[model samples]
Target: MSAEEKKTRQMPKGGRKGGTIFPRIALQDAVGYARRLVSKTHTSRQPRDVIYSGVVGAKAGIGDVRISALKQYGFLDGDAKSGYTADELAKKIVAAPPEELPHLYGQAVLKPTVFKRLFDTFQSDTVTRAKLKQRAADLKVHPDETDTCVELYVASLATAGLVSVDGDRITHLASADMSETAAISVVTDENNQSLSNNSTVNSPATRIDAGSDTEAAASDIGEEDKNGFPVPPGNSAQPAPRANFNVNVTLDSSMDIEKLQKQLELLKRFGAI
Candidate 1:
């Protein structure tokens, strides 16, 4: 045989000598395989090599293949070092903004619970109870039930688009407009009640009558006390007039007038007016 023919015959079918051998798989392909395994199992505790071999075998319909490609490519750590927990990894994946996620975990569907964890991380830092109580007092509202009051305030923040709920965390998303809206609502409600109370106090029906002799004597004593003068014997100063303006405003403005009137009627019927 010619030397060229002899050399050609000695070469393997696909270019190598002896038995046919394939080139090592690319790192990207190995990573893809590993990712697929993790996603399928939904657990990270499995033996990394076993999972990789199973995935590759399942896909290629071949005999046991070496997972050395995964190790060489840095897809598998292969050491006993403690890495971040699955929950922590899931949290990181979820917290990643929609635009930035494609660069991190590649293309994969994230579960809702994972997203919730991300949200919780964002919302973990929130307004404290003391701060909320101070805010309530500043707004002239009695925060009798501090716990419920804070919860209601947080709900209000959510409704006003100033905050969002990410799992158990209360994430603040307040903009200048949102703050202004909340502040304006609180101030307006307080001012409206103050004006209503003033109107009620100045109403003619609430004026004290001084026509009777007993009423005149009481007024005389009250005037003496107001003028910083001493009162004579057997003459007691009148008690200061206490005007109680119990103003209850309806929170639901979306309700029709007829519905509101019916609610008022119901309250009156129940002697709650």
Candidate 2:
């Protein structure tokens, strides 16, 4: 391949880079796929077509995002050409009792360097969806996928019960064993500051809940944050003309239709003016 052609070649999704590309699907999604495999194939490697036919979604197809997620979580093994089978961790999860799932899933989640880093960095600190996005920006995540990355990461965290969301205030919960680390107690002070591992952290100032998921996620991660997903520049003609305006709105957890309508109306009024 010529130098220019090599530069044009796409980067491999995960195995090669740590956190450059996060899991497209959530933990529960990967769990669901593995659960189906346990019921149908019992950990045996089966042909790609067979697995695809047996475990199909409402969309009539299982996507690469899901397959990649399963692999990242150490839930699935083998390749499309070599066939696919549920890995040992997957077998254990399927066999474990109800209460053990969160613990097991927590371990699987941290396998990805990105998730692991986030968990390590934010496990002790108060985290908002916006805060996570900011951290992602710090990690050089692409602007276009800022919301998507946070959404999927939040989904995984929610599934593992790692963080509890309440009206934009996220209280980090003690999850599975990180092996090298010892267990600790969770205590909340009068001000809702989390005290854990003998350390104290005041509640975050931005108590914005993670309920709306993507509302505050469109934060800028810089123009160069093209982590394999690039956000192309808009055409010159597409820029707003008359109502040249920049507005910052704080959308609360009460994202009811009425509230949404009001915000929409406000923006529409600007356009009309």
Candidate 3:
């Protein structure tokens, strides 16, 4: 290649505004370095020299690359000027329980400034190797290196359980927190709709109009409304204005005696049964 062409190739492409540039290493590799650092220093701050010596040993060039990767992955905190330390997440990944690893790694993978931004941008969409390569190019990574970098980033995400790959297709996996939030929303909506849509208690979802069988059933109720069912409001002639409500109870084979007993006791406490 010509000298000018070679010079251009050396320049970082994706997003090249400023600073020391890319890590050029996968997140797993950087984390291995972090575990080595933690074995000696734990999470305590250490001068860059001491920290580097612990992880890198004699390979100075590879050390720079790996160290840059660690900082990018958020495994390392502090700066060259202030020295470096293993970040809390990094220490946890190295020593925390297996149950905690998935979450910790999910968080760590997004620490890199470039990958995090790209993830946010494409979070809702399925990712492809080609798509990631283009994104890496957008981040100022050189065209030739985009393919290699995309593979590394994808592999790192997979290690963290942050995505599932189907042959050539890759899908972003939801975090446990996101899955939990969605589950809660679904439960709340279903309950709100099922309990009170102005529908009847069982069989038919008939309207609870004035003087409906529902009100007569309440005449037997003493004073206060039981289980939200409207009771007769005194001896007034208003005939207990129409009110819509629904209470659907299902008795299935799975309803064990112990479970049924607890529910019955609760209802009895409230004079509901």
List where candidate 2 sits over 4 angstroms from the true fold: 1-19, 56-62, 174-273
What value of lDDT does candidate 3 attain over all alpha carbons? 0.69
TM-score of 2: 0.54
Reference-based lDDT, residue 70, model 2:
77
On TM-score, the candidate that comes out on top is 2
Computed on alpha carbons, the lDDT of every model, listed in order, comes to 0.44, 0.67, 0.69
lDDT of 1 by residue, 78-159 (tens): 3323421123333344455543433333212111222222223334356455655555444434445434444544543353
Of candidates 3 and 1, the better by lDDT: 3
Clash list (residue pairs), candidate 3: 13-140, 13-141, 14-139, 14-140, 14-141, 15-139, 15-140
With a 3 Å backbone cut-off (N, CA, C), the pairs that clash in candidate 2 are 167-209, 168-208, 168-209
lDDT tens digits, residue span 1-273, model 2: 799998899986753334477777888878888888767667467876666767534322345667677789898788878888888888889997665677688778878777777777787467788988887877767767778887777778878777777777666654344332223212212223434532523345334553354554333211322233323234446543345767666676866877667656656643632
Better of 1 and 3 by TM-score: 3
TM-score of decoy 1? 0.20
* Model 3 C-alpha lDDT per residue in residues 1-83, reported as the tens digit of each score: 78998877765568443432455777777777878877766646777777668775634566667777887777877877887
By TM-score: ranked, best first: 2, 3, 1
RMSD of 3: 18.7
